[model samples]
Target: MKKQHIFQNALLTLLMLFGLAACQDREILTIENQSPAIVMDLSQEELFLDSNFPDNLALTIAWDVAKYSQPTELKYKVEASADESFEVPYVMGTVSGSQRVVSYTVGEMNKAAQTLGLTANEQGSLYFRVSSYIGEAGEYVTSTSNTTMLTITPYELEYPTFYLVGGATAAGWDAGQAIPLYKTSNMSYIYTYLTGNEPFRFLGQTNWNPLNYSIDQAGTRENYRYFKQVSSNLVQDGDENMKFTGTSGMYKISIDAATAVQSIEVEASPVAGWDFPEIYMVGSMNGWSATAPLTMAQVSPGIYEIVTPLGADAEFKFIGQKDWGDLEWGNILKDNHGYSGYVGPKGDNGNVKFVGNGGSYKVTVNLKAGTYTIVSQ
Candidate 1:
């Protein structure tokens, strides 16, 4: 009976241990589970940034802490885009802590405006969403808040410096007579004028000796073309120079020397009073919503320019007066809007497509010239 009593006590002890182990396992699973949801509250309905606002002033946004099924370290990102679809959103702010707030100063917001291709002094709509991430080193789960709208006017940008030279240019190879072009606040280059099928080149320095650039291929302006050759010694014997192959009229010439590989653009020159006061871009890049168009800057009279993000085989078109008015333009089913240029009516303008890969490119469109060019930067 003593032995039997001892066995019974041992069995009870084992059963108790099993019960405690089961409870501990359940607790561990509960602590590791997560279910995060975005809080709906946003700090402001309309965010205004003006020249009078202190450059250092910051725009702060607060939201409810995202919930999780288990204990988690959350990382947050504030995104802004031209459309509510958030297809090509920009990460305006990021935080990795318990805080659910994000802030951007007047300067930071202005930079973001420039990034979204917003023109100076023009009001545009921006979509905002807060993304939350939960996890440790190797694992993560993400949730996003409902998108909010912000109407803002960005300050004008400080453009870049450019000069025109070459025998085809109006100055006719005279470096002293070379025409000077204005730079956008974003630092791209532009010059507007008339040029026949003559050849022209750009001078890095205002002189003929040091750096003179020309397109490596004639009649090709859709891709990167700017090439520098101090002398015939720099290139092989048969290398070609960039020239004006399109018809001669008012022309808006654009250049992107911001990167190591330079690019060039030549489009029909806009004729003042004949063309719309403003032009905007709408297509796959911006969700193709006619209501929201990316405004183009008039670098010179009749000449409009914009730097927009493009995707692989991206397609888009120019909208006159910011709506689906009678003044729409698109590719003519030939040359792909490169040299053949574009044509239009109102409805079914078709799409101007890009065959190249994706990145932000400098696009120039000439209203009177009825021509355009998309140069990779």
Candidate 2:
């Protein structure tokens, strides 16, 4: 009787395992092979965001429920970009569940537009689309909606101000005449010029009442000093004075307020008395824009140098002045070394070609030798 009872128990367990397998097979067979198509209402008037409404207004976006044969937790996201191609769109908002709706405030819309490369205060058109995704990693599936149009104007954010002062600077001890630093894409400050023997510090304000920057060591360029506003009269110091120990030459000084870090690099200074006030590089990489050319540093009498990233098939020419004045420098002749192997202003004007795997390179141009070298890093 005990043996019969054991046999019954084994038979019951086998039936249960077979039932689970059947259910799994049914679920797999029900999964749809095709993705759902997003339904959008484009008949409504084009959406618009006012420049004055920085954060007051809200825009609602809705779509029809995506259909699926199998159960899935779908996540919907609204995206926008400057171009209709939606090559690199910015996610404005997201939603989940049957609601299928997302509301974006005026400020939020403006930020999205700006993130898509829209300029501030300028009216512009943008393309909007919705994307839905299910699962993660290996099993992930995605669907995109038809594009919609949006018009918006973004607002610019206030930028921080900085000035170079103290004895090491070109301005010397004159706080009122401290050298101003320019802003860059990374929100850091950059200034390239010749330096003297004295130590220097950066002031947050124009008058230097607070926010002074220095270095931990008197002579080192790295490990910068920072300060915090304690009170009306008190100030908290971070490090020592920032100074250059070696001989004076052209240098690029960059200060990052966000990370409280600083870097100093030796660069070529301007020729003592070159005819051209400024020299720049105009190339295919920069859209060949004569107005916004990359400036080169004059390290020696007739030699100019610039450290920048070069792309494959990059071609460039040197311009004597800001605008396309008459003077220009191009390739002299093809050399066995490689692209950009040799360059000069003589003979037929040819764009200097850069041939490499594409990376950061320090380019030095010597007009007298009619040659150029691309030092890949």
Candidate 3:
């Protein structure tokens, strides 16, 4: 009887094991061969961005819900291309499967337009689409959705160059000695000394003719200072010249030379004059050779610039002479010296730590502003 009971128990255990195996075989997950088409629609077909409304909503894109045979999460990447074939695409970002809409502000869309190489203040087509993926890496399926068109117009992000040439300025009407203003997208600025009773005007280049700028009238108001129109020594016919009537001192001159308007404003400056003949760059690039340092051309009174190849983590400093005996500048004077886009006048300041990949860079030093900038070319 005991043997019969043991045999029954053993048979029941074997049957339970087979049932578990069958359940495991049915739990397999299968991916469909083809991906469903993702449909996307835009809120606006044409986007005209305004700098004033940078934070305002520019556009919203909605897409159809992605479906799958089984409950699975989906990933989406927004791609933008200039052409339909998508030879090169600018990736916007990734989104979760549940997000069916994406929004772009005026600032964001404007940048996107610029990235697409759209001409400033001109209409251009920017093609956009989404790429959806299913499954994890090494085992995934990808699908591209229908293309959409956007007519975008971006604003100009840079301003034209301007030079100061006149009797009041140090250049003193000599086109070759004309001083260049530090230019930006919105305006051009210069901090220099000016004298009264002398007339001056702006030149597009070092020479005459072509592009010249002067006061619209004899005078314009700015607090206590005044730039009265000076009719004498006009480079071109009807090209009005202006003079500073205020007391002779250092002034901060800002120019707004847009296509629509030519404006100039003057104010007193607290900074001292920039007076340096020549500056040289001594760094790891030249094996820290002070005897044979790289020379930087003197662009303005105290401003110097140079274009040279820099390696990763390049360190350097500026000196008035090649041997670095006297005048020198490096990182700012602080307890822990580091990179801050500022240079100290003392020679003991820490080295200027370059934070970028190895490439050719345009190094600019503005002693008047007590700062420096490095831009990759």
Candidate 4:
């Protein structure tokens, strides 16, 4: 009897343990409603490249997830090739995410696609896919997101090659003449002229002012008129329709002949209506004022000229201020929108000239012996 009772008690205990474990497993299985679903949404279906960009470019992949119910981990796999089938992916990479929107860069894949002779807008395609995982006690469930495709295209940029004309290599200021803003069959071109502040007039032709002129599209080459200084509030394209708001001060610019300074000039002119103004020079070598200034004088009314002891290889720009409404303000003329020029050796003739409505100036610089690179603003 004692043995039977012990055996029965052990059996009952075993049954109870088994039942409790089964109930626990059932409760665990019912604890979570369902697994989360992840989704991906890319910003664009295609990527474009411009001539300025290399054959390979970086692409951005943005994605969004949905139905995320449980704490999940995500990983991304990008498979790309020249063929749509991706028989053999030329490029592959992995990423991880678990957020609603995840972003990834596809730079390596793009390069691999390019190596396969896949040009922009070609039939070749790149593919991307993502996988998500939800962890459980003993096992984890995985779900794969849909694949995304992107078509590559080309980008377009419109800017023409600018040319240089005349001037001394030693002098920083050289003349630039507009050869052709664009060589292609594009007719849309705008002109802008700039100048420092001062009172000066266009040289030559009394009625024809540097600030007076229009872009000529009909002619192959346009002649630029000289500039003279006169105190008048004239608006020009270089001003971007902004009125000259500067003080009246004599600013000067000096070029050193010994320094191989060939020529000194300014570019970008105000619109036609205003006269070139007078600008004086002030520098350390010139005592910092017009009175004690160097041999800074107006070569012509609008054009300030100076001869310096610096070598031809030296570089400097013309500085001055515009005189408007009794106040003197400084103005820094920009070349092709603030682009600097390449200065070369003196005695090498490469001069640039600017011939537009704003003003016509010549820059003669010797890039190499008997060789010149001229640019006109």
Model 3 stretches with alpha carbons more than 4 Å out: 1-13, 23-27, 33-37, 134-141, 157-377
Which one is best on lDDT?
3
By TM-score, the best candidate is 2
Q: How far is candidate 1 from the true structure (C-alpha RMSD, Å)?
A: 19.2
lDDT-based ranking, best first?
3, 1, 2, 4
Off by over 4 Å in 1: 1-43, 52-54, 134-141, 162-181, 184-253, 256-377
Error of 2 at 352 (Å): 34
Question: Pairing residues by index, what is the TM-score of model 2?
Answer: 0.44
TM-score of each: 0.39, 0.44, 0.41, 0.28
lDDT of 2 at 9: 100
Clashing pairs in 3: 218-229
Candidate 4's residue-wise lDDT over 1-377, tens digit each? 99999999999999999999999986664234243343346666776554454534356554545334444455544445556565665435555554444343344444455544565445456666544444432134355556667776432223223221212111112222221121122111112222333222121122223332212223212443211221233222231121222332221221111111112222222222112344333333333444443333544433344444432232232223421222111212223211123221112112222223323223322111111122333
Per-residue lDDT value at 279 in model 4: 37
lDDT of 1 by residue, 1-377 (tens): 99999999999999999999999987775433244445455555565676566466556777777766666677877888888898777778777787777667877777677677676788888788887765543135467788778888877644335557765565677887665554433333332444555666666557764555555555534232454222221221223244565556545455554322345556553332325678888888888877898999988656688988787767787777667765566653323343234433344235787765677789898654344778888
Scored by lDDT, model 1 comes in at 0.62
**Residue 197's lDDT in candidate 4:** 39
Total backbone collisions, model 3? 1
Query: 1-377 in candidate 2: lDDT tens per residue?
Result: 99999999999999999999999987674456255436365333344556567666557677777777667778777787889898887777667777676777777776676666677778788787877776543145467788888676556644445677765555576778765664543243332333444566676666756555654443433434443211121122224454555455434444443222233333332322223556788887789998999998988755788988888788888888767766666664322123534443423346778775678899887553334678987
